[model samples]
Target chain A: MAKQQVISPLPGTFYRKSAPDQPSYKEEGDQVAVGETIGLVEVMKSFHEIKSDFAGTVTKFLIDNEDAVMAGQALVEIDG
Target chain B: MAINVISPGLATSVQDLGRPGYYHLGIPISGGMDRYALRAANMLAGNDEAAAVLEAVFMGPELAFTQDATVAVTGADLPPKLDGEARESWTSFAVKAGQVLSFDYLKGGARAYIAVSGGIDVPLALGSRSTYTLGALGGLDGRNLLAGDVLPLGAGTAAAEGRSVPAKLRRLPGAQAELRAMPGLYWHRITEASGRRFFEDTWKVALEADRIGYRFRDGRPLEFVERTPPFGAGSDPSNIVDSCYPYGSIQVPGGTEPIVLHRDAVSGGGYFMVGTVISADMDFIGQLQPHTPTKFVSVDMAAALAARHDRQAMLNEIRAMLA
Candidate 1:
């Protein structure tokens, strides 16, 4: 089985869940399908929904919630 | 036919719709300043809407068409002539081989677009032919046009004769333009007085305007209500957080003059974005010349979406007519 990773396309603050105090969309060891919403990235006041490009179980989150990410920075690792 | 550039205008470059899906790499989507005029020119020339065309600023080049082809000029109302004969804009005309084409000083607006039947045959960079002057990529070596440069036209057949611009395609009247904007990332940091001034007062385009950005002369310096630390781990006060800026984002450094980012603007900036001009109004903003009076109007997301849908409907009707 191959492992996959989701990456942030833009530099901004990342939110693990949709809003504050909400459960994260995915947790470590959780299954996700391609195009599934993984998280949201807030850049310059615009909130962009981050989607998983590959189907797999969550392995680990690269960055914590509210952490700033750079372009092409990895966000999540997933194992198939 | 080949045309020789005698004078390459103030800031001429080849542009198209723009390069998308690469903002993660910090590559700004550089394209035509007036996308509406560019697309209109292409449509009249019977070319794809995204085809590359010459974006001439202030003035245009003096050239001789080496072959017979059809061309259309749009956007700014620059006085254009062929072989010294005055010509009308927003209409296609036959350019005979050896006919010299020249444009006089712009009487109104800042930029004008010249479209040939087959479009400009410029090398593609990053899946687009738009010139990102800052990155020095795309368009005749990624710089402003210079004297003695000869641009090549793409290979394509021409449409029938007598295609003129539709009345609806003409730009709205009035030298005063009101730009609609959506609240940006740092919109809340500005004071209520500054926000009111931003929407109520008219700002004049300063002489410092260029492809990168347009500086406007706001009546008074803008002051932010809260001083949010710029993005970055550094303790330096000048450090700003790196962020992706969409087209039409207006950034104010030190809470002063408003600078509207244009096609050739940078991907990210270290300043506060008070607001972003709606996408549909970007073309109108591009045509603004120096000293032009303009105002910013705030609109909700729903209005912006509706405006976009309306534009799409119009475009679809035009396509249907051509089909």
Candidate 2:
């Protein structure tokens, strides 16, 4: 099995859930499916979904919730 | 015919060139932040240069077409998609009724313009369809687009598809940018060194930057010449007896951060305006992203007017090419 990391497509603030009160979209060791949004990256006050392109078990997130991130920064890891 | 809003991306609103004549009446000429890109998208969609279009900030709205129409996406590259399939930007594409148009993450630039063949059929306010969100005037009910809002479309012809702008001609937004400005007005009120340093320092775009004004991160505090406060002027050296603020006016309050008033800025203020961003460079200012390192370059009036002429010529060239 190969491990892949989901990377931020743009630079902005990263949030694990859709809203502050919302639970995490996916948890560690959870089975993730393709096209599933695991988090959101906000830029210019606009929220953009960070979708998982690979289906796998969630290993862990590389960044914390609400952290400022850069483009190409690894956001989450997955074991496929 | 109309387009149904599925999800209104952060602050999606209808905007055209703007309302200019009513500024003295306390109205801001709120319009497309990046007029060049707005016109580009409009021309590609075969609409008039000043046709109302959706100004989508970094993110774009998910719109469902109720009728077949042609559209062009310009300005910030939100990575537009039609029916989940990637569509080319800075160009026109026809979408059939029921096809959903959305966007991927922003690749570059700060805003995106979506111009449909027939413009958004909002009634004009003061001769322009531009939205002034501060006053809640114009656009669709004078505010940002909301989910479920059905926008009526005007009747117009569309150009052929695949009308792509040359990459060189497109905007290049980056972590660093330089904008040209013409100094004067209340500039002499500032210490000579501070005025010189203003142009030399690289200021970061503050997070609060918006259509009304862009406040840059203060790298060095500016110093103003001491003078007796005029009758209505506040005690601060930066305060002037209230005066009219020109578009792109750069004013400083508290002698620190410089705020460059933009297209939607208020008509007048009590602050000392040190310089004005050249008309041609205003579009570049609109494309600046937050935290970007920005610089101000001082230019003479001759150069400023020359740049304006060059921009006008470029618009003409674009119109002829698109035709």
lDDT per model, in order? 0.78, 0.88
lDDT of 2 by residue, A1-80 (tens): 89999988666678999887889999899999999999998765467899999999999999999887765679999999
DockQ of model 2, rounded to 2 decimals:
0.22
lDDT per residue (tens digit) for residues B27-106 in model 2: 99899999999999999999999999999876689999989899999998778899999999998999889999999877
Q: lDDT for model 1, on a 0 to 1 scale?
A: 0.78
Q: Which candidate number maximizes DockQ?
A: 2
Q: Candidate 2 lDDT (Cα, whole model)?
A: 0.88
lDDT of candidate 1 over B189-261, digit per residue (tens) = 6778878877888887765777778778765767566455643724433225767776688887766678888
Best by TM-score: 2
Candidate 2 TM-score to native:
0.87
DockQ of each: 0.01, 0.22
